[model samples]
Target chain A: MAQNASQLEHFGRALVDLGLINEELVVLDPDVAASTKVTYFAERFPERFIRIGISEQDMIGVAAGLAASGKTPVACGFAMFVACRSWEQISSSVARPELNVKIVGSHSGLSPNADGDSHQTYGDVAVMRVIPDMKVVVPADAPEAVEALGAIVDTPGPAYLRLARGATPVAYTEGCEFTLGRANVMRDGSDASVIANGVMVPIALEAAGSLAREGISVKVVDMHTVKPLDTDAIVKAAAETGAIVTAEEHSVIGGLGSAVAETLVEKRPTPMERVGIMDRFGESSRSYSALMAKMGLTSDAIEEAVRETMRRK
Target chain B: MLRTINKNQVLILTNIPRVPASITSVLRGISRRHKIPLSTLKRNAQILKEFNLIAYGDPPNFSGVELTELGRFISNLTVGEEPTVHGNMVQTRSGFRPLGTVIKDLRKTVLRMIAEAGSGHLGASLSAVDILAILYMIKMKHDPKNPSWKDRDRFVLSKGHAAPALYAVLSEAGYISPDRLMTLREIGSQLQGHPDMEIPGVDASTGSLGQGLSIGVGMALASKMDGSGSRTYVLLGDGELNEGQIWEAALTAAHHGLDNLTAIVDRNGYQLTGRTEEIKAMDPLADKWRSFGWEAMEADGNDPASILDALNACDLTTGKPSVIIAMTTKGKGISFMEGNKYSRKTPDAQELKRALKELT
Candidate 1:
């Protein structure tokens, strides 16, 4: 098994690799290349890297410009700033034009725990998902993040890549297939299903393991792609399991839970519960794990939500 | 009197086939048969009536237009050929037309289009018409026939409300048919109220303010990286400078040393609602750009000669972006409409007629 690594670092490395293959690949940074770990790409391919300073809006605009000129530009910044501060630029300059620009927003959700609510972004996926022609991807681990980056890079259009700051358990092998908009069934069961993305996928697997010991069968799915959502997988899980629990490291309002619920209410109408931030902001905490535990983003929380959903079912 | 008329007007006159035909029926017949927009037919009909080459049915039972004897003679004379004149301006192919003639026709076309569309930025479009005319007709190295040519220069209309001006210039340059200009802001038309990339010759899609310079910077950067040697030009409104992103883009263009990019601020001194200074002071604008590491220059934005000089001067700069703070009247050409109050107002038919007369 590959050693667990920070998704941000993996993304940086994958970007450099992508630059090696795609000559047109360029990187734009809003003064967070080191924190976002795109410094690796900046160092390797200096000409292709644009240091856009502290202006996230300008970074997106410049990225859109580059994309319009036939270059695939990956704009890297903190999730809070890139996804929120420059939302309109992403909408008007990039998404509306359907340009091939990849916006990699690092330090997503509670991953930037010590930075508190100001830096922690729990609504990146929600804001990005709403833009037309914007593909939203939240990879489960470092390996998956690398794969997701490759997929978005290969696909020609606007896309938002949500990445966590800290390292988590590696969820996939080195060469695991990462098809965009297709969910991966991590573990299968019969009673209910736990659909999760980003940092919550591994926790969901752990929760399914605990449920297995209790003989309460549960299915764990890694729904990495938030937009162009795998509605087929969601509907099948809802129909086959009859109950669903959505887990993510974001707000329950417009993140994975809301997405799954929206799909179910329209397609299958299954009983469900959401395990995520309860529409509130994050604050400073001791560590990443402590913040996750404090925010009810763990195996225990997912297990409880799954059981509650099954009881309703 | 061999008055100027475009090929479309010629088509309308010759296609009448008979006198005493209702203007509506003649327009519908020509529109359906030739796939011309009814709006174009209607506007051309009005123009024909104004020139005394056609007469509409009398009021109370007015229905359509009929070509007068003069209209018949002129149409017969110009059959199977381009119109020899377009509103007192000698008509010629896009690249070959004189700058003055192009600017005059573009101004008239812009007013007529806005009047037909019923709503648009008349003042802003008129203010930028000469600048757009100079760029498309003389300065910018672009191919209307091959708009997507990789090595061709690029233009981004950042002040997108001025789309009427850009569309007029584009049609004059042969990027779009003159008839398509009537479809401005109509549903399903390529000529949107704001510039969209779906329109041929529009390099970057822009509408929201202050975003075009960055797009221009990106295109310039890409051109530099690929060694394409293509230049990029962006037209921004002075009022649009209130947007912070424009400054952000300003710093970016200079930081990258993008000498191939040029930004022309159509300094008409007003935005919608009021004069730009009263709304938000942007004095020492040229100094502000120079402080941001750009080669700032000024020109009489509404003058074809001055605009040509400024655009030519941009090519002399090295290792830095260039900006031309083109000073211009808000609603240029027409005497009454040349100010802030007319910023977004579409002209009535009477106002359009007066404006066209001023242009001629």
Candidate 2:
């Protein structure tokens, strides 16, 4: 049986692991080291870690400057702040110059449950995807988060790694090979495909399993890299499956759903449906699961989206 | 004895490799690339040979010229390095002339480039020229030959609209050829309207205001972490202080105790629209920095000696970042254009001539 793991914890541990080998790896936190779990890396590598005391814009500029001076800086903060609050700084300083700055946005989407819409970030993926030379990654699970972290650090230029706050079902075992722009097909089917990322990946897989009992085949793909969308896999899935449904714990406007829809419209024009927050803000809920359910980001919603897309096909 | 080589002669010497190349090919290449006349290239090449920087292949029908040992050394030095002796004058890495002479030349270049481009921030560029000259010439520890030298001090033009000044200083410092200065703001030119990382010797690509000090803080922090002894300097416009990000960075710098970072605010009293005070009252500016825990200082920004004195006065071991509020006139050299409205105005042909005369 697969156990649940925290993506933020895996991300923090991965930074420490990478810091041990790569001397140029420097971690920057905007005063949320404890919440973001970057404290793990900060504890082991105090000299390499810089606590920026809640200034996201300054954190980004500093990251760009460090990158300009030949140090690989990973600036971490909440998605709501680091992605949106400092979007201009990220675009001008880091993306325009193509600096090797890895920006991590923890507590993304509805995962920041009780914090409500103010703390939840549904627009990060959309904003980050729009910047040129910026690679957007949202890992599916804790183990995959570690792998994704290593891959982004190894690759040059600016990258945004989106991490959910709560623990997620482990989708991959340790040492899974994670490529930057390629999508991983979790399960292959013929009737329709469900492409998702972040917390939605596990939910999509569960949806697929449920549909299998109902004599429906659903392909599940973890579309981790959002900016450089895996168009090849998307086209392949659209052609083979004949229909597609996209799921994400973010706004349907510009997250994984839009990325897949744009590709499908241009390349394959397959029948597709997007399962995500429908242009509304989230509210404080009892737990992460309750908030996600209230936002319609569950295995049932993904199943409904797939069945609706199959009907259209 | 080596005579003081003009910009044309320096261009010729640096273009030719240490290995032998035909004089005709060298002349043709330099003429075509820099758009200089073939005759001028020939004269400069001949001067280089006379200076013993280059040697003829043979006495009868000298077919080619190659850099002599001294020629290679001088050429290497021309790429913004140590000084070279030429009669009574010394050619430092900053320029081939004295500091005052180089600054006057830079002001002329800034005006002429803006005039040629037909659009640019004239007053702001002129205001920053002297400070840029002092930094590139006397203050900053940088090597044009190796712009990415790990331990070299970094300078960020946070007030990126003054690119003409930075470009003029860079050309004088040999990071770029002087002829390239004419291509300012032109399509496909490396010297963009704003400072870009593509240009040589540019540490960070900056144009949007209020973002530079944070970058400097990062560089300073990286230097501190590596114990790399390299310093980072950032220049900001006074009007740019309207941005909240500037104060945010100021607090972060002082909080980190980034002693290696020095920020200079070009208090020219004018912004894009109107007077800075009229737009946003930033009085007691130095006090604001002081309150944020920086060691605030003041300087006559247009005066090279004053700027240098203020820069030298910074105590780097105090474990606190410093900010110098350098008070400057918008159009420091050109008299008629010394007003707030000239910030974005390009000098016409007559204005360029008049400005050049004033600079002389």
Candidate 3:
């Protein structure tokens, strides 16, 4: 299967088109109208949607109340508050009780290249992963975003749906199947598994492609659900692939790398290297690629890291 | 498992001196019927008993409820004091307050709570203390003893950082035990240095600065959807006003015409880093409310009496939600803390001891 139309609007339109979600699904936000690109959904279902100005905390609180009363609320806000400011409510009111609220945190994980370090989310994944029973899904590109949204039609419990800014390159094929906590093996190889999520998915996939030419068949796993790290896949990859590399656009402390390593170390120890921001705030001026490269997030970096892990193999 | 306030006396309303001649036989007839369940009859007999329009029988099979002299008194009063010619009126025994001395107590409790904790948001708490005090004390009909009492008024501390004052007032009002006041900010305590509804007095756990009011608005709308008359009140910090979410809630409140909702903005002139003007200035504050279609009012937050009066007055507005901008002094007591620009600094114990010297 392949996933296409890598845009948030595409996902939103699919939600309405599939009727898997009610048109009554709301969009409550804290002032990121243009960034998440929900204007089209807002236009079609104005009554169902709301631009909740800039009160991120109240937006989540009110959304929780609305969710309690049976209306599905898709609260949109900056990744920081959707992760930080209203952190308690997300943990207590929404996730603790297992309320059916979908928190759409757009511009997540260093998506704000120019908005400066203040807007960049260095560790959005870690903040949410600690919340018990939370289902965190970080889409690799617009295609995966659409698939994740379409996939959660009947899914339950509190979920963190992380989306990035536009110009995201497509990484998955049309009709690509997305599952919660289950990693999809994008590439099959025994040399190593370059497990990746969010914007780094394509980077890892591209690295695998580059390595393939050099006769190093690297298995790429798009580990979208970072919290419940796909242990079965990582364990299997380690058992068969002999080596691994994990990458993300988040702090190395509690992001995808930690999630993968925790699983592998307990189940099956595999030589691995994590490619991410290491104890540093993000740079504001650099383009997405330049910033990622500077922070050692390039496909070249993943290839090199994978090569280093292969040495252990 | 919960013991109610002791019903030692029966309050008799005797203004309707006698039973009408037409209802006399009905009263006599009710007095002869001994098999009726008491709770069902008590709810229906309020007005009838007040006017002597109805009377109670000797005794029922249920041994749980006893008949007393007060019960006899309640059986004779008429229920027409509600000033309506309607067929019937359902009134709660513990209904809404009318704004007065109760607010004064609520306000005082907030201050006392802060002083007890020795660490808190004095500026925001002082800013909202009076309005919130008025609400718990005079405006809302709530059971402090049973904070989760079904159908009771809902109060949300949206500007959550002001939990110290809120906890203080709730404890003073008997919603929380006075003993728990000392446990604030301590590890494993229900008082988590913020408003946690898991705590007896709090309705929503808020401390992230700008999230409580919307929860209040949702609770308000929920009550309305159920067609229940329970009102919801929320207190928001002025610093929280800068968060765009407040406006979203404000607009949503107006769109719904949540007449059962009342919001109080603690319009003190300070935030965490600096004075509101130096941080993010919001002038024409009242005009902004007016544009949002909310019936806005300005009141002195420190003056208990005025705050009580203003909250009571909110009900007079025709078909709209209201926001009361309470003008207050930051760090408003114990002269040294009063108007203290550095609102967040922990006053030295020796310095605080010095500040309290004038208290006696």
Candidate 4:
């Protein structure tokens, strides 16, 4: 877990482990087995792996059907397509009746940088969070992704796990407990707080360290679960820190920023700033870091948002 | 009412008081009791006779309406007793019933239940009744008492408007009570407007079109993975073929060599707006399935025996999925409802009475 690794690889290994433990486990992919990392599962359990060939709608429907037949289906697809193409199926067939279908969306956020804007998904969290009975989880790194995959399988309803495209900075040195609808505070401070999800968690931690060195201590909270947003942690962070800044690799419109704002406005209002893509689509970038910089998703942006929130406070 | 409940029976209701209850006498009694005209009742009775309920003799002959023994039994059957709707003597040791008899019983139950619900997809229900009957009673290996049996064959009704048909068939197979059939779309009822998995014997929940085939594929894949001999059957509407997801599922099933999966398209010709031809002409449907790598065949959807035969004849050894293009008529048994513009609408009291008569 200390080494940077592909979240998709962790997902694939988790699926195989889940299949070995539970005989009712089935995996589905929409022609991205290699990229989504379900190839490992398919190789280990060939009979339980189903490849639907780039049809997200069919894959979701099949997953729902398999879940109805008492099999827990872990469907893998690109975040850009699965969150948009088969949203209706995911809503009607799976979430509506609350089936036990786990959706692992690889290439989440701007991680699929080289594939251009069309491949990079920045609205998956927004779309998936709005669906009723859907549990949305954004792991901090590969270790959390594996833990979240196991948690999703154990949870009894529809769940969506947003995964990164390539190797992400490891945030945990060992496998840690990942409970659905819970947040883990990585650093504690009373000056200001930086709440982030997915790939932004490691950057937020770095920003917290930078703020600490500058004598402006900031708390860092990894709010991986987005749907059942950790309202308790958000409120606690606001009350303790007196200021808050939210960062995510997704758009600021309806992603982590909006979720934190919505929670704070009702429970504990606090001065806040959001760090994400403001209001435009992504463009082709040479590297993930380049896209992160272009979209203002770096640790510097989080530090700037925290400074802005502190000045407002 | 009793004769309508049992299509093969002929019991008459009259307004006139008499010793032996005749068809005209029963009509006279009803007219007198309801304070309506004997002429009006006579007209309604004439309509019933045209529905083939009452065999007519010469005019003015009170003996024209014949009361068969079956009709008498139907009229006298009470709620507490075990009732037989159709006259039969043979009891199969293997519990196999004649498909024709099952179809008739299923039709009778569906017509009565839909009429009781007062609002349902009558045309689609009637159109798919025979197919469901064949699947549940003849073709599929299912145990009604043990709905969750691991090795049982699965059926998903992608064309969920025919839920009444499935409910009636499930009732006949003892998965549901005959009395529960009347609560078709009521709140908190196990039988929903579409096939919900909460209902016993319903393998999956489906109402939105083109989703059942994928579910069937999933079940087939799961069964194959489990090394079970169970098969999966999906019933689809012809109009539902317009959905792109169906073809996606078709490709998946074929690519996976899901030979245990079988799909049946109920080509009932009509959809909500108009005929399938006018909406979307899917004429080369069998060839399309074949091109998609399935063993495709066509059968008379209204004939349960033919459906069973076609289902049996499907080649699962070909390492491809099987599809049956079942040519059926919307509103199959009811004469006035067949291909009518208002076929999907619920029948009024008079229409229900007419349908019941024809069904009897």
| Top DockQ prediction, candidate number | 2
TM-score of chain B of 3: 0.69
Deviation (Å) of B106 in candidate 3:
5.7
Model 1, span A107-207: residue lDDT tens = 99998889888998989899998898789999999999999999999998999999999787787877688899999999888999999999888888888
Chain A alone, TM-score for each of the models?
0.98, 0.98, 0.93, 0.98
CAPRI classification of candidate 2: medium
Give the Å shift of residue B223 in candidate 1: 1.0
Better of 2 and 4 by TM-score: 2
Clashes of 1: 3
- Pairs that clash in candidate 1: B22-B64, B23-B64, B23-B65
Q: Which parts of model 4 have CA positions greater than 4 angstroms off?
A: A1-3, B1-102, B108-118, B315-317
Report how far residue A36 has shifted in candidate 2, in Å.
0.8
Error of 3 at A165 (Å): 6.1
TM-score of chain A of 4: 0.98
In TM-score terms, candidate 4 sits at 0.82
True contacts kept of 1: 0.73
